[model samples]
Target chain A: MDPQSVERPPSVLLAHRMQGHPVLVVGGGVVAQQRLEKLVPTGARVTLVADHFTAAVEQTALQCPQQVRLVRERYRESHLNLEPYWRLILVCLPSGAANHSDDAKGQSKSESDSEKVYRDAKRVFGAQQSVNVADVPALCDFYFGADTSGCPTGKGEGQLGSMQLLVSSNGVAPRYAALVRDELVRHLGELPLAQSLDRLDELRAAVREEAPGPEMVAVRMDWVCALTDRLGLRGAASMDVQEELKKFKDYCKERGEQVKSPSQDN
Target chain B: MDPQSVERPPSVLLAHRMQGHPVLVVGGGVVAQQRLEKLVPTGARVTLVADHFTAAVEQTALQCPQQVRLVRERYRESHLNLEPYWRLILVCLPSGAANHSDDAKGQSKSESDSEKVYRDAKRVFGAQQSVNVADVPALCDFYFGADTSGCPTGKGEGQLGSMQLLVSSNGVAPRYAALVRDELVRHLGELPLAQSLDRLDELRAAVREEAPGPEMVAVRMDWVCALTDRLGLRGAASMDVQEELKKFKDYCKERGEQVKSPSQDN
Candidate 1:
C-alpha cells in the first residue's frame, strides 16, 4: 500500500457566530468559490484576495456585497498584514501550482511562505485564528473537506429554524466523503428530526415557564427522547401537531404542572 | 420565536496531524469522554483536567498510557500554563454548572474565568490554537459537535485505509445533530464509497508511475468520477473487482499507457 493512500483520523471543529469576523480567502477558483459559499452563510466578513476569480466567485460577491469583499490580486505576505483583523485565512490556490515550487530549495520557499502566513495570522489574532491551505495538507492548520449539500440558507424565520448537516472527510478521499454525505442528507431528509426538535424547543420553553428545576430538565430530556421515538415510528408529517402538543400538556398536567400552550406564548 | 433558536451557519474546519499537539479537555462527563474518543484517534496528546473521571475515560487512559494524561483536578487558569505545547482546549463542563454563577457579579466571575482560559491558551500557543467551551456558545471560540461514529482506528494497512465521517451542527441543536448523524452513518454503511476510494488510490498510483503529467491528473479525476457513478449503480460487494480492474486497464491502455496491478505492489 502506498503511504500517501493511508488515511489519518481528523480533528473536527464547528465554528459558531462567525458574523463580522474577518476572513481572508486567497484564490477565487472553484475551491475558493465553494469555501466562500460555506463562509457566507456563517455571516463572516470575508475578503477574497485572488489575482483572478472564477466567474462564479465574482457572481457570489455581487450577490452578497455586504458579506463578501473582493480583492483582485495575487497572494502576498502583505495580504495577511493588510486584513481588517482576519480570524481565519483560507488559501484555495490549486495544488498543481503550489507543487511547481516543490524541489529541495523550492519546497522550503513555498513552505516558508505558507508558514509565514500562518505565523503572521497567529501574531495578529493570537492563536484563535485558523488557516486552511487548499490541497496542501502539510501547510494547513485545518482542512476543508466538508460536504455541505444539506445546509439551509439562514434567511427569514422558517429557513433559520432548519437544521444544517455537514460531513468532513479530513483530507481523506473527497469523493467518498461526498458520497457518504449525500447519502446521509437523503436519509436525514426522510426523518422528522427538525420538527421534533422544534417541538422540543416549544416544550422546553413551556416547562421553563412553569417549573424550572433540575428534575424538570431531566423530564424535558425524557420527553424529547420519547417524542423522537414516536416521530420515528409514525411519520412526522402524518402526525397531528395539536394532538402531540395536547398529549404533552396532558403528561405535564398529570405531574401537577400548569403548562401554557406554545401558541398562547406567541 | 426565541432569537436563540434561529440557526446560524457554521464554519467547519478539519485539523490535520494532531499527533503530539497538546489538548486540554476539562470535565470528564459523557461529552468529555466522547470528545476524548474522537481526539485520541487523531493521535492528539490529551490532558483530561477534570475534578473526576468517568469509568470509561479512566479505561481509555489505562489503554492508551502515552496518548492521554489525567490531571484529576478542577479546571483552573493556571492549568493552561502547565502544558507541553497546548494547541486546542475543550471545555465540556455542563452548561448549568457554568451558568451557576450567572447573577450580576457571579456572571462576571464565570465569564472572566472562561475568558482567562481562552486568553491563556492564545498567549501560549499563538492564534493558531482553538478553544471550545462546551454548551456556552457565548464563551467558545469554536464548538465541538462532531459525530465521529464511522472513524477507523488508524492502525495498520487495512484500518488506515478506511474513511472517517464527521457531522457538526454548530451548536444549533446537539440532539438533532446526533440523530441525523446516526441516520447518516446507517445509510453510509450500505454504500461502497470506501472500497471505490481504495480502488481509486491504486489507480492513481498506477497513473503516477506510467503517465505523470497535468493531463494524467485530469484523466485520473475524470476516471474517479466515472467509477463513482458505476459503483453507485452496482453494489460494491457484489461487483467483480477483477473485471473492474481489467476495464480500467483497458481504458488507460487506449490512451497508450501501461498500468500496474495493485496486488503486484503488495
Candidate 2:
C-alpha cells in the first residue's frame, strides 16, 4: 500500500567459513574486541586495525590460536582495501559526544553534533567500505545473528558454533542485532542437538566412501526425522530424496553399513 | 588462503509472504501447489496462471482464508502483460519435448542451426522462471528454503520450528535447494525439544514485559538452564523475554502488584 514500505530482506550478516579468507576488522576498543571474540574463532585471518588497544582485546589476541594481526595506528581512509583477501568489514566505535573531543582553540558545536560529524566523515571517506556499522543497518551489508557454537564434546566439539547470518536488505539496528541474537540464543537452546549436528557432520564425512543404495536412503530418512525432532521442529520431520545422498555416509555408519557417494549424486 | 574459493550465495526464490507485491506463479501442478501453499499462508496475493489446475490446488485455493486469484489461461508472452498487477514472475511450468515444440514452432530459427537454436531456446526462453536453472538467479531475488512450519503440539506448541533458506545469490539449481532442505531436515530429526519450541515461544510472548533484571534474569537463566539440562542442553537455555513479561502480568494479577517493564527498572 505504501511505496516507502518496500519489503526488503531480513537483516543478516555472513559468518563466512574461516577456511581461508583474510578479513580486516577495524578499531581496537571494547567494541572491536567484541567483534574479535566472535570472529577469530571462525578461523578467519583476522587483522585488527587501530592506534589504541584495550587490555582485554590485547590479552585475548595474545591467547588466540588463530592468526590475529593487531596493527596499532590512527585509522585512515587508505586502509579500506582488503579485497581479494577479505570479504567482510566491521566498524566498531562509540557514537555521538563520546566519539569526539573539544579543543582549547574553540568549540563549534554541541557534543552530539561533533559525534555525528565524525561518523559522517567516516562514511564519506569510505573507511567502512567492507564493514557494517555497529547498530546501524542502513550503513551495513550484513548483521551478525546469534549462534551457539556446536557441541562441547562432539565432532566439531571445540569448533566454534556455526555462525548464523541475519542480513537485512533494510539494514539492521545494532540494538536489533542484539535482540535477534538473544532471541536465537533462547530459541535454539538445545545443547544435545547442537552436539548431534556436529556428530552428524562428522558422520557424513566419515561415511562418504562406503556403498550407496536404497538402504542408505532409508537410514538417512531416519536421521533427518531424528534431527527435526531433536531441534523441536515439527515441519522438518519429512526427509526428501537428495538429502539422503548427502548424509548417506553418516546414515551408513549409524546402521553399521557402508556406501560410496556416487559421482552422479555429486 | 584460496581467493577464488569464496563461498557464493546460491540464488533462491522465496515463496513466502510476498505481502501485496504483484507476482506471477507459472504452472498448475503439485509443485506449484506447494509454492502457493506457503505463499497464501503468509498473505501473498497469488495468481496461478495455468491452463491445467490440479484438483488439490483448486480446492486449496477455494478453502484459503486469503484471496488467491486463479487465472486458467494458456501461457503466452502476450498473456504476461495481461495482468495489470504482475510485478515479479515465477515460472514453474512442465517443460520437455512437447512444451519445447510449442515454443520452437512459435519462434523462427535458421534452418542449418535448428538443433543448436532449439537447445539454446530451451536453455533460455524455455527455462521456466521457477525451474531454478543455472543462470536464472538474475531473474529472482530470493529462494525457497526448507521450512518446518511449526510444531503443532507439545512443548514446541506455538513456535516456528527450524527453517532453512537454501538461497543462491546466483540462482543456479533448484536441486541445491532440495539438497540443502534435505540436509536441514536430516539435521533436525525428531526430538522432544522440537515439539516444545512452541511452548517456549508461548512462554516468551507471555513474559515480554518483564525486565530481564536481577530477579527475573536470574529466574529465567535458571529456568532456561534447568529446562535445557533436564532436556539435555548444558547451559544454553534462554527465555522468551516477552513471554516472561506475560508471566509478570499474571504474577501481578495474582499479587495485585503493578506490571512494570524494564523501563520501570530504572
Candidate 3:
C-alpha cells in the first residue's frame, strides 16, 4: 500500500451562515487578499493581523471598513487568546521566492516567529476552531482548493440564472479539481438547475398534500428518479413543468395501490 | 426583490483534518444517521446526545465504539458547557411533526427544552464553534447541503482515480443542490480528472526546474489551458503523457523569446 493511503478520507461540508461571525486572518499578502474577497460577501467580521498589507487588502479594507479590520502589527501569542470570539482562523504566509528570500538573508528569527505563531494559534484554538494555513496542507484543519471564479456576492437581482459550483479534491489533487470545476461551471449555466429545483419543490408539496404516508418516502424517491431521467433526456432548460406535474400525479396514483400493500395486510 | 434574495450567499469550504476532534450531535433520526455516515470517516470523536437512537446509529455505535459515544439522554445546557473541548455541533431534530406532536400533547416542557437547548448551544458556543441545526436555517451557523454518497473510506489503493465533489446552495434550494450534486457525481467519474491532475503536477515541477522565472506563472497557466483543451478533444483515458510533455517543452521553447522580454529590459 502507498504510504499516503493510510490517511483519512476528506468529508466535504457546506457552511451556509457565516454572516456576522468573527474570523481572524493572520497575513497581509496576495493570498490573504484572495481570502478577504471570498469572505466579504458572507458578511463575516474579519480581523486581519499582519505587519503590512498589500495594496489590494488595503483597498478592500477601505471599501468595507465595517466588515474588515486591519491591525498593522506582527502576529503574537496574544492574538490566539481571543478564543471565545473567533470562529475561523486563516494563515496565509508568503511562499516560494518570498519565503526563501528571508531564509537566504538569514532572517530565520522572523521565520521561526511566524512558525511559532501558527503553532500556538493551532494549539490554542485547535480543538474548537477551523484553521487553514495557506500552502501548508499538513497544518491545516481545512484546505481552500483553487476557486478560479471568485465567490459570488449575494446580490440576487442580476443573478437570475447564476449557480455556484464547488469542486473539492479534499487537497488530493487541487489543480485537477480546479480544472474540472471550471469545465463544469461552463456547462452548468446552460441547464435550468434552479428551475428544476423549484418545480421539484412544487411537486413535493403537491405529493404531500395529495398522498402523505409512510410510503411517501419511496414514492418521492421514485418520482425524483423519473424526473431526473426526463431532465437528462430533454434537458432542464426545456422541461415543461405543468406536463411533468400531470405525469407525476398519474405516477403517484399508480404507486398508491402498491404502497398500500403492507398496510392493507396489517 | 424576491424574499429569498435577502438571504446570504453560501460559502463552500473543504475541511481536511477532523481526526479526533470532539463533535456533538443532538438527534438520532434519519438525518442524524446520514450525518454520522459522513462524519465517521473523518475520525471525529462523536458524542451523540439524544433521547433515542435509530437502529442504524445504534449499529454504527456498536461497530465503532471508540469513535462514537451515545449518551441516550436529551440535550442540555451542559453539552455546550464543554466549550473548551467540543469543536463542531450538529442538531438534526425533526422540525414540524415531532415539534407539533409535542405541542399537541401539551408537552410544552419538552418542546421548550428543545428550543432552549438550541438557543443556549448557540449562545454558549456561538462565537467560536461551528453549529448547524437541521431544518431550522435561521438558527444555524452553517448548513449541511446534501451529500448522497457516503464519505469515501480512504483505503487508497482503489481510490487513485477518486475525487470528491461538494455542491451547496446556501439553503436557496437544497433539494436542487442535491439533485445537481448527484448528477455531477455521475458525470465526474467518466472524466480523466485524476489523471490530468497527476500529469499537471509533473508538468508544474518540470516547468519550475527548466524555466524558472517571473513569467513561469503565466507560462504554466497557458500550458494548463492547452493541456485541458487537448484532454477535452481526445479524452483522459487516452492521454499520452510522454507526448504531452514533449509538446510542452516545445511550447516553452517557442515562447522563450516572449518570456525573456521583461528580463532583457531589466
Candidate 4:
C-alpha cells in the first residue's frame, strides 16, 4: 500500500512514564499549581523551586510528599542540573515573571520573565533537554494530554487503579478533547472496567501458555487479536474462563487458517 | 483537599511532537516497520539503520521519502552521535537478536539480540536520551497511545486537517484502550469538527478583542469555558457569530460575578 494513502499527523502522541522520573517545575502560581496537580497524578517526582507558594500549592506539596518536593527558594540555574538529568523541565511562570532578585535584575532587559526562565533552562540544560514553558506552544518539546481518559480516578472507592486512558487533541482543540473525554468517562466509568481488565490479563496468560513456541507465534497473535475484538475487556470478566480456553484450543487445532470471529459463535 | 485523597496514576501521558525532529530506529524488520508506520504519521525524520530491509519497510521509505531516510548498514554506535542529539533512540529487533556480524558475536553471548540492542543503545546514548526497545516496556521511557482520537484525517476530502483527539490506557491494557478509541472515532468522526474548530477560533479572537485587559482575564476565561460547555465546537460554527458576540458583551456588563451558565441561557 502507498504510504501516502495514510495521512500523517503533525505530531506524535506518547505517554511519558513519570512514576519515578525527575521533573522540574520553576514557578509557584496558579498555572504552576495546575501543572503540579496534573503531574502529581502521574506519580512524577517533581522538584519545584520557588520562594513563595500559594496556600493551595503548599497544601498539595505537603499532602503528596512522596510525589512533590518543595524547595522554598527563588529560581536558580543550578536547579536544572540538581539531579543527573531531568526527564522534563517545565517552567510554569506567568508571562513577564517579576524579577524579585534586585542583584541580577539589570543583566537582561529585552525578554519577559517567562522568556528569561525558558532561556536559562535551555542554556543550562543544553539541547538534549525537553523543556516546556507554560502558555508557550512554540518552544515546547511535548504537550500534555488535554486530560486523561478512563483514568479510573472516579472508578469508585477513589483507588488509583493501574489502568488509565489519556486523550489529546494535538493542541488543535484541547477543550473539545476534554469534552470528548468527559463523554468517554461517562460510558467507561459505568462499566466495571478495572475488574474486566484484570480478567483479560489472566486470560492472556492462559493463552500464552497454551500457544508456546515460535511456531505458534502467529496463532498467539491472531487469537489475541480476535479475542480482544470479540469480547473487549468486559467480556473476559463476564465470560466463563474455562469455556473460552476450550474454544481457543479448538480454534488452534485448526491452525487458525480461517478468520476467527467469536462474536458470531456467541 | 488532602493530596492522598486523590490517587495519582502510575505514569504521565504526553503528546510528543516529532515534526522535522530527528529519531533513530536500529532495526528494519517487521517490528521496525510497525514503528516506522506509526512514526511516519507524526512527521518524524527517522533514520533507520539495518543491513537488510523488509519489502513493506522499503515500500514505506520509498513512498514517504521526506519523513524517512534509509541507512543501508547495520546499526553502529556512531549512529547515536550522527546529529546534535536524538530525541528518541528506538531498537526494534526480535529477542536474542542474532549477532549477524559474527566478528563481534563471541564478545557477547549471554544476552539475546533484543537485550544486546537495548544495552547498546543505553551504553551509547547515556541516561539523558530516552531509549526504547520494542516489546520491552521495562526499558521504555514512554509508550505510544493505543490509538489516535478524532483525527481529522477521516473528515471528508482526505485532506490532513488540524484537530485530533488521542486516548491512552497508561499501558495497563492497550487493547482495551484501542477499543475505547474506536468508539470515540465513531462518535467524533460524524461531526464537522474541523470547521467548527475554525469557527471557535474566530469567536475567541472576537471575544479577546472586546474584553482586552488583564482585569477582564477572568471574564474571558469564564465566557470561553461557558461557550464550550454550551455549544462545544459544533455550536461555534452553527450559531450566529454576531449574535453570540452581542450576548457576550451583555455578560461583561454584569462583570461575570454570578455563576454564568450559558447552558441555561441558551
Number of the predicted model whose lDDT against the real structure is largest: 4
- Candidate 4's C-alpha runs over 4 A off are A1-9, A98-108, A124-126, A149-162, A190-192, A209-219, A246-266, B1-9, B98-108, B149-161, B205-222, B242-266
Instruction: Write candidate 4's Cα lDDT for A136-199 as tens digits.
Output: 5666777775555324335522322355555555555456656656665666665666666666
- Local distance difference test, each candidate: 0.60, 0.42, 0.61, 0.65
Q: Over the stretch B98-143, how does candidate 2's per-residue lDDT look in tens digits? A: 2332344545442212232223423433221112211122222233
In angstroms, the error of model 2 at A158 is 6.1
Stretches off by above 4 angstroms in model 2 are: A1-9, A12-15, A64-66, A82-85, A97-130, A149-191, A211-266, B1-266
**Model 4: clashing residue pairs?**
A41-B9, A149-A165, A165-B168, B96-B112, B96-B113, B97-B113, B97-B114, B149-B165
lDDT for model 2 comes to 0.42
Docking class of 1: acceptable
**A1-266 in candidate 2: lDDT tens per residue?**
21112333222112233434566666788768877766665555677777788997888778874667787865544454433334455666543313243231243454232234334334543231234555433444334433333322233223213322231113212222223333333434443333433444444333322443323433544554454444332222233334544555455556666555442446
Per model, the share of native interface contacts recovered reads 0.35, 0.00, 0.47, 0.58
lDDT at A141 for candidate 3?
A: 71
Off by over 4 Å in 3: A1-8, A79-84, A96-114, A122-126, A147-162, A194-266, B1-6, B79-84, B96-114, B123-126, B151-162, B194-266
lDDT of 1 at A262: 33
Q: How accurate is candidate 4 locally (lDDT)?
A: 0.65
How many backbone clashes can be found in candidate 1?
5
- TM-scores for every candidate against the unseen true structure: 0.76, 0.40, 0.70, 0.80
- The parts of candidate 1 lying over 4 Å away from their true place are A1-7, A10-17, A98-129, A150-161, A168-170, A192-194, A209-219, A233-266, B1-7, B10-17, B98-129, B150-161, B167-172, B211-219, B233-266
Full candidate order by lDDT, most accurate first: 4, 3, 1, 2
| Model 1 lDDT tens row, A123-152 | 666544567665455556665554453233
lDDT of 3 by residue, A1-266 (tens): 21122244665455546677778888898879988987887678788988899999999899999999998877766766644667678887653223332123444543444355556665775556677766555556766664423623332213323245556666555556666766666556556665655565555555544445433545655676666655652264466655665666666556554332232232
lDDT of 3 at B26: 84
